[model samples]
Target chain A: MTLLITVFAAVTVTIIWYKNAPDTSMQLGTLSLMFWGASIMWFVDAVVGYMEEGASFFMQDAAEMLNDLYLGLSVVALGLIIWLVILMIKDPHRVIRSLITGTNRQ
Target chain B: MACFLVPASEAVITTVAEKIIRSKEKNDDSNNASSVPKVRFSDKLGWLNKMLWGGSALLAFEHIWHGEVIPVFPFLTAVQNGETGEMLAEMGTAGVGMAVLVTLIWGGMLAASHVIENRKVDISSEEAGQ
Candidate 1:
């Protein structure tokens, strides 16, 4: 099923990136988990929809749309998560300085 | 519409500003004290929580609009297949179920990630503080 393929790709990509990357600050484990989980769910749903008795084109279309939504959100969320991770890892000092500015804490 | 957009925009701006400030604080602490860690557990969890809530809102809106409102139009329903009701029900159930699952998983993973990350950061910060 398309959903299954998408989920597989997403999860595989995430694990590969997470493990092989020299700097895991590129992707947070939690965000990757979310992407994988959602993709898997969509994949499962698609498979089930196809096998269910009396499944129609209308229903199939709806299911596909739902999967698309999940995939889109997963990409957007992961992208943001990756960027944040990189930002934090690369400039902890600048971040710290900004926080201390105009604050009571020294 | 303007009223809605204005409040939403303001909230988004506030959130981004807060995140930048928080990240800066963490970095500052790390510098004066190399012992401090770069990221915190709560920060990751907070972002995950926000996403879950945002997703829930979108799903709810979809449920109301497609599952209820659109299907209820008199002319549309008159011409639509009798099975429209059943189809809507299925869509509603599936959409809601998936939404809930994602939200719960995200929350749980966020919590776990937070704990692990926080422990690492705490160890570093403690050393730095010393």
Candidate 2:
């Protein structure tokens, strides 16, 4: 469940990142890389679980799946929060800087 | 249960490495006005750190929420429950695999950026008709 959520986030962000490749101000690349890294990690875990449990790996009960979904969404939210921090720090377009200094009044 | 420990450990090492490289890179290069923009080694390592640290932290949180990790002496429930062997196996396989895969992907990103930077140099040189 975490794997699916992260993979979906990764793919969506990657597509958006590529589409707006020249606009590096948002730091979408970093966000996408973070998700990709997570997706790869969870993918490895799923594979290892499958190896150990064989066909039973995918047969999770509703409770377990619900827990996984919550965890997955939390991971995605944390990733976004981290990305937001990076974006603000970088201030690639100097939006924050401008807001602080009041320089872009035009 | 303790699988995220592997990548967390790797993140710690790379964080130290980044500090060392950053110290080394404190030298000046602002004099060379015509050179291509250099991507600092410390910065690249920083990207790897971000990937590793962020993922490991979230995974740790997940484990904590699942009650696999605890705020106790042994720390890990697996260790307390005599499942240390299974925990170690998960760490060896899933944890190591994730760390390696993330590092490899970071390396690929580095290579791709290097190529793009070189392309910029080529375009500028073409403008200069060199």
Candidate 3:
């Protein structure tokens, strides 16, 4: 199931990039790398979850704690997505500059 | 829930407006004949917003790894003391929510302040140049 999702995410990203981004080697490479990195991180997270899956009652509680932590992080991520959209709309020029220069807003 | 986006949105708009106002102030103060220095306050606020956004993204990435996309390990079957789990869960959930709320407000404040300081910078530059 996890593998399937990972593949789906990667393919989706690829499709989006192919359709939206300019046909540049750098863009393609960057997209591929992003998917690969995300996949690897997801894999590690799943492993930890599975390992704790069959533990004792106390262990299960610990796993649950970890799971909650994960959920909280998701909220933060959603916040960021909102932030990014806001930034793009409110300051498109600045956003573009930041992206091109790789220098954070100072 | 729907209204939550308003404060943050307003902050960004106001900040940008302030920047424009400040720039205009500098331009009008032709007697000063000085280029406006980038305002420190606004710059700092920009940094704060970036940090908040970046932090949030990292948190989300962590969530995705754990929740929906990947579970590298087997499921945790061990159940700890039910009472303790319940307490910890409550605390964690609350803590996360609070952290996000605080950060959002902080970002808004920073943005608003930046706009004001940007104006100040414009005025000061004009004065100095004169």
Candidate 4:
């Protein structure tokens, strides 16, 4: 289920990035790539889980599914946080610099 | 060890940042000949970024509401014990649903923007012909 959710998110973001590929200012491609990378990681995890648990893996209880969901959400959130930090560091719009220098009037 | 994954993830983000910078520089050089205004980073992906941040905030709130943020050690244990797992599942479902909705809305906006831009071009060209 976690892998499914991440794959869905990754695909949606990738479509958005593809539509705007010519415009590189916003860096949505980075976000898309991050989600795709995560999706691949989760896919591997799901495959390994299925291999170990065999058919029982398909019979996950509600509690187990919930736990997996939480873990997946955490991964997504962490990815966003990392992306935001990188954006700040890059400061493509000078917003971070303005904030630090106290010069931004807008 | 799981903590080590954070740095590895960060390294990927750094590579993305470098890619964006390099692309932007190339764009600037190409546009210089045509005297086109450079695209501002904030303006380009502002909506998408906001949606991502908003989703993260919602997830964080849900985590806190379920007491998963505090008592971190117990939170890990609770995963195995099935405590509050149902609530967590519901929240996760809602969070992902919201993300999908946001993406759809952004796509709609992009299509609308493209239509408006095309209309403007058509009108300008018509006026110039007149």
Give the per-prediction TM-score of chain B.
0.40, 0.93, 0.35, 0.56
Off by over 4 Å in 1: A20-38, A43-106, B1-35, B38-84, B125-130
For model 3, residues A1-106, the per-residue Cα lDDT tens digits are 3333444555765676678666433243233333333343334334444655644422446666666555544543443355456555556356667877898976
lDDT of 2 by residue, A1-106 (tens): 9889989988999899999977877988778878877787788888888998999999999999999999989989989998999899998878889999989944
> Each model's TM-score, in the order given?
0.41, 0.82, 0.26, 0.46
lDDT of 3 at A43: 43
Which residue ranges in model 4 land beyond 4 Å of their true spot?
A: A104-106, B1-130
lDDT of 1 by residue, B1-130 (tens): 0111222333365457657877877777767864444445446545544443333333333233333324355423312546665654554555444545554665686677678877998887788789
Instruction: Compare candidates 2 and 3 on lDDT and give the better one.
Output: 2
Q: Highest lDDT: which candidate?
A: 2
List ranges where model 3 is wrong by over 4 Å. Answer: A1-63, A72-106, B1-6, B25-130
Please state the CAPRI-style docking class of candidate 4. Answer: incorrect
Q: lDDT per residue, candidate 3, B49-115, as tens digits?
A: 3433333333344434544223353222112223446434533443334334544555676678778
Query: For model 3, what is the alpha-carbon lDDT of residue B102?
Result: 41
Give the candidate order by descending lDDT: 2, 4, 1, 3
Clashes of 3: 23
Candidate number that wins on TM-score, 1 or 3: 1
What TM-score does the A-chain of candidate 2 achieve?
Answer: 0.93
TM-score of 1: 0.41
